[model samples]
Target: MNYPLIVFRGLNLLVVLLCASLALGAGKPLTDFSLEELMAMEVTTQAKTPQRLSQTPAAVFVITADDIRRSGAVTIPDVLRMVPGMHVAHIDGNKWAVSARGFNGRFANKLLVLIDGRSVYTPTFSGVYWDIQDTLMEDIERIEVIRGPGGSLWGANAVNGIVNIITKSARDTQGGLATARAGNLERGSGALRYGGKTGDNFYWRGFVKYFDRTRHHGLPGETAEGDWDSLRGGFRSDWYPAAGEQFTLQGEAHQTRAGALRTEPLFTAPFARLNDEPTETDGGFLLARRSWETDDSTRYRLQAYVDHFQRRRNLLDEDERRTTLDLDFQHEFAPNALLDITWGLGYRVSRDAIDSGQVITYRPSKKTDHLLSAFAQAELPLVAERLTLYAGAKAEHFESVGLEVQPSLRLLWTPSTRHSLWLSASRAVRTPSRTEEDALIVLSVRPFDPPLPLTSAGNTNIATEKVTAFELGYRGLLNDRVSLDLATFFNFYDDLRNFEGVPAAFVLPPPLPPLDALFTTRNSETKARSHGLEAALSWQAHERLRLMGAYSYILLHVEPRLGEEDFDFSEEKTPRHQASLRAWLDLPHNLELNTWLRYVDALERGPVPSYLELDTKLAWAVRDNLSFALVGRNLLDSRHQEFPVESFLKNSVTEVRRQIFAEAIWKF
Candidate 1:
């Protein structure tokens, strides 16, 4: 009985069997689809136009591509591993510290990652360093995970979530595809892609990749273990000389080398100061969109972009460059009384360069930054088949918060066909980075004048990081195999830019010195609360087997107002308990079988004593472009440790113990 009284009596028997199937009218909520398949699965980035997920109201989560190839995972943060208030970890091997809903670790500055819509963050650590975040996971095609506060439509770091990553056009990838893999720990890999057609309004695609990874051992004898190698290339094209107008071209380039291991002790003292270091980064973007459709509902779009970014690393002596020019436009009015409308305007400019080791910075003497924004959204349509009301607002002007207004209000209700309800109220922000506007501390540990040197410097007038979010959501399916997506949030913080510790009382006339108490970056007054519950299930029982699962339970509190330092271990590193079981077996000569079983839970730090991880997958297909695979990770080897300020360990490392891999694919 308990268990929240069986979840409030199973949500009151699912709202009384969906109101007795809408009093038997039986056709509602896309009754069995149609309206052109519900406008091809209604979705307009959560309220720009058409919306459906039983009638949208944020808290969305979709990662299709067959759930990223059935979660065997090949990046994209391992397919965002079953979303649901995501917080995927894995801090090494190209680093990763994704977050959503709560302050998560490793520079997870309020989340807001996009691709294809371009904007990979990292304008000097804004977020996302997911180890050179590679793309081309089969050219994506889905991955829109929004979890609370999109700031009236993506503004100011989206405040905790927004990971769009849409792609898959080259006329829908018209040709070649290939992949090969090997492992003992992901030791080798390969990929190639090809697409055609370049006349009658161009369309093209090209991709090439190379990879090497084998370096992660560290534990005995303590030798550096940071091996990595990478090479990447990219291309995308599209041109529609007529018909609604569209033009897009994209580019990417990469180079990486690492063996990195050095933590100042003496220029040369062999034990673990390895190096083979060479680092590089490249970027390119060009966008132009023009849309005009005076009928069938109306449309308008005008977008522009130009980008060039570069990064050079030498362990720590930065050389960064960024040049950006972006502009935006969008307009869709009419669909009248549903208030269907969307608005837009945007601008951006950036430039950065820094070079000075041992932590040092020289204020951004104005590389450049300018962003003016405007946004509007409406959807109000209540009672024409249930209820819905969405509102929006966005007004930004920053060269330093000259103006700011991010608003949101949403509410959706469906009184039939499998009830659903949602509500939201938001105001999100999280700006000021360069580690809180240029953090510089050049040299320390040179007290006697040998190992450490000067020290202390940082403060570029830091300020900009605010939030006020509130949301509530619920989804339903309760039958024909179950389904549920629930949400809850309450985040209220201000300024909040950590790193503070100031104490100094000096008098150095005795030898050659004085006070030395410093730890800059400040802006406090914080708060947090991210309630949760996300459930997913699909039990076809038999009929080719199926039993999917996903569970999330979050309850972060973070509120220590008197003498800080309480960000709560982010509640034991994600995965409150994730379960999985999938099958599609149809074994009979021609062949076709797929399998998966996963369970991840148990994790801790602070008294450190918790662990558990297991994964599995198997596949065999002889059609639909062939397939063959086998992959296993941890498989219960269990040992765990993924960042706890592990900083090149003295212990608290090793997250994978047993791994097996193999893969092959082809498509034409």
Candidate 2:
């Protein structure tokens, strides 16, 4: 299969079916719900209060549970691809590069991800390891995605966007459920969940899930060496002691093992060779939260969590162990009718122990770091429902860097009940990570006469990366059945991380070998800027039919100072243009059909050809509690490459092949 031919054929068939249905049928559709029902959806990720989607000031997107189920998505990252401004790419079978607007790479550092308020980003690399980010898809309530800077609320690394995964409460899932799926690429997967009442006022739920994934196709259609598997289990408990107070506790554990083929440099003869290595990872976390409301309309919440993470990998000859503890509190009050205020405080501490080898080594074998933050925000209704202003700032102290403050100002104007306009300006920062501050990596070991070694050393004086962003947005409901959201933003970045080489040669004792100079981390004097626009539209054409479309455009420019090396790959790695369209149809007899079409522009660095992707899912409910589905993904092409070749550690590129899967779901 290839582009245009297969894509046009599929689209033609879909158009004919849709037109015939609309011209022949005369009943209600699945989208019979009113537009007010859609706007009334509440999201809490934006601020302290759960506000309607239309009232938020930021460029926010909500992925509902129905969207997840209908899309036939197996993972969180896969589901995120539906968002308008997000950039999600598969690097390998077990790795993903996900960001927003621009700045995408294997280690995308500017995006922050959280699960039930627990940060999943690694401080060592300032990125997320997607393989272990697993959850029961059916248990997810919704995913809130903010496409612009959220540093004033979420702190560091939230420079680009924020993704918050919120799960259903135990009280809402008081039943038993099971799912089993199998496919050529997915291999096999299964999950079991059970929820019930633990006491008169306490509800609890537990779940266990496991999956195995096969390898991808190489450049020449050969099977690549990328296979992975994992096992995970978790539980949650919710207690309601009174009408105005609630308590919740949750914990999860996961173990994952994976393998990949890599070509690594050697110190002796045969400088490089292809080899396969096994990677092992495991982690666990426990969290607790309490919330209460007073008679005076004041709300308070306290949350705490502890996490333990360990990764043993042969690819880098590295073993890492980390433990973290976090505590946070928030208070919201309405002192007056026109003023709403929120204050929050947080503290986090992490300790890491790394076992290094010839590949990379940390200067300090063990280290501990602390981060403390305080933030407050106020919302004032300038003219009641017509105009409003929001102002907030956060001050944070890190062990490596002193006090840093992030601030934001936003204004919202409601011209009518059906339309809203919002504008915002914000400042955010990305703090230095462990890799940039205290790591030594051996790029290559040459087996020459003197056994010379090339190594890169981390710099302790590396400065933080900062960004100032301005955004504008418009949201409107054209009629009872149509709605649209549009947003634009410009971001200016300074003090970005760059590499500078220092020429030096040092001779060691007779027992050791000599080393040559290599590049080190530094702050660039130049600056970078990016501007983009995102638009999304939805239409409920019929009672049983709905259509959604999204488009995004981004332009990035970087200026390197005089006499400095212009070496930034972010602009080339991210796509400049992307678009997607989806359709959801509810047929007779408990049958549902969903289709998605997406396009991504070519990468500047890879010079990879642009591609179109098509996906479809057909599902039937045999009974009220039992269902089955058949899903097809990447149907437009037999295979396509989504990421460029990575030669740093010799991680090659693999093509994603066409996949079909069958799933069975049961609920009681």
Candidate 3:
């Protein structure tokens, strides 16, 4: 069954359009909210400018800081499973292979990631090395995930999706705190943080964290045990020198040690893998922005930022450095029905050195990319505040891809104060990976009955991946105490590259003999679509007790054309159904109780086995400025796997059993 998102999108659009067109002609007029209210929408453009996810035309979800704190989960990937259409694979204690829609693996290349506007994808593998991205979980302000192309606003590598992690401002976390964690699986973890106000407008904070974990001890056979350790430290500072201008500085340094296994075809020998791989990384970002509320009716922002980061992976035996400088300015003349204009340009210089025996180089290679882009979006209130439409397009020029244009159109309507509807369509493109365009790998030739063709290494010709997406959503305040949010989306992809086998024969002579097959990069000429529905509800049952739950249903489809018909690859690792429940109950005294339950369905087949994870926390105010917390995760001792999946060893890997920890927090 071809579950193309477009088919559903088309139907949704027609219905929305017809309803909107008719409502505008026959319904009562609408009320225009204040700019403050419009901006109340969460800013979730994922690396784009600050805009509410509801107002943005793209398909996006925001995992707020409150959500993170309430979940009582340990890692970022664990929180990611809550989002539909995204594939999250917790490969091991210290590693995660995550992507959107599909193409999920240890090094998921198709997804682009940003830490406070700085790109974190590895140039060596064309993806983010999730294991290396570490920071204090408490420091995260919010994480915005977009499940479709964001190429126009964020250049390339966003083929499948994008993830942006935004940290909390120094001013928001002002105090001194210490915490320690230990459990059955998570043997040891600790954190220390301090922050203070430098002046009326300046605030600074610093933190240090260390973590050690025991690997999954599966059902005998000595199949799944590896140890992991990591040490990290970071600091952040924010300054509001004046009323409307702000300066932000943040940096982090970390080192990690983890066990790894090697893969080879030989069956008679034992696996001799690296006992432990140690990696160290350091990075920082500086940003300055000034905003002026010009005359109450007009507002504008001018901003610039610089990012410097470096990383060293033992397996790669090399160090990579990236430095980026960017400048942007935008203005909005508003009142609800007004004009908004935005434009920006950025420059990035990435330099690296490869040590011997590493995949990046026995030698070293360096390349710097330049990018220039301008974008403009306009919103018009047609027929008073009853109907509104927005259209925007981004024109970007990359050093390699030349010029690319991404355009978006959207419409929003509010039939009544309680009901709202929106529809959007957009086009985006993902840039090529550095490895596909530059890396050199040796190919091993093997024979086959069908007789494959062979070709040597070094293919310089590659093109950027592209995607077109459509989305629709509705929001309603069912009652004074209840609210709901619902959305659906679909995306189409082109020029997905995969390795293919070539026939090895008498094609070459001497030192380079022609082999039966070689693995080279080729365009799959494939198309993929993801259609899913996300529904969430929040009910304020009482002044101190609130309940919330969310559910997502997604259907992913992939079709490969232009040869290799037998390779029917569906986007794996993403479940079709995910449901979560959260409840906060306040008992008689000053004590509070929080509970969370998440269910992730298996994708391998019918009546898929879903995993249930439960978390509970009890908080007691110890003093005016201090509190104690008791947290228990996987309370069920759920022997089931958190991310149990096929490993590179042709078997499956399971996560550790249960964990319970006690923590304390202090504010001054």
Number of colliding residue pairs in each model: 4, 4, 11
Candidate 1 lDDT over residue span 12-130, tens digit each: 64345344434544221211222222223555566645566656777777766665765567778867867766767664455556787556665677888877666677656577766
Worst 10 residues of 1 by lDDT: 26-35
lDDT of 2: 0.84
Model 1, C-alpha of 500: deviation from truth (Å) = 22
* lDDT values, one for every candidate: 0.62, 0.84, 0.63
What is the per-residue lDDT of model 2 for residues 37-141, given as tens digits with 9 covering 90 to 100?
777789887785688888999999888888899998898998999999998887678777799988787677889999999999888878887888889999999
Among these predictions, the greatest lDDT belongs to 2
The TM-score between candidate 2 and the true structure equals 0.96
Question: For each candidate, what TM-score against the reference?
Answer: 0.31, 0.96, 0.81
- What CA RMSD would you report for each candidate? 24.8, 2.2, 9.1
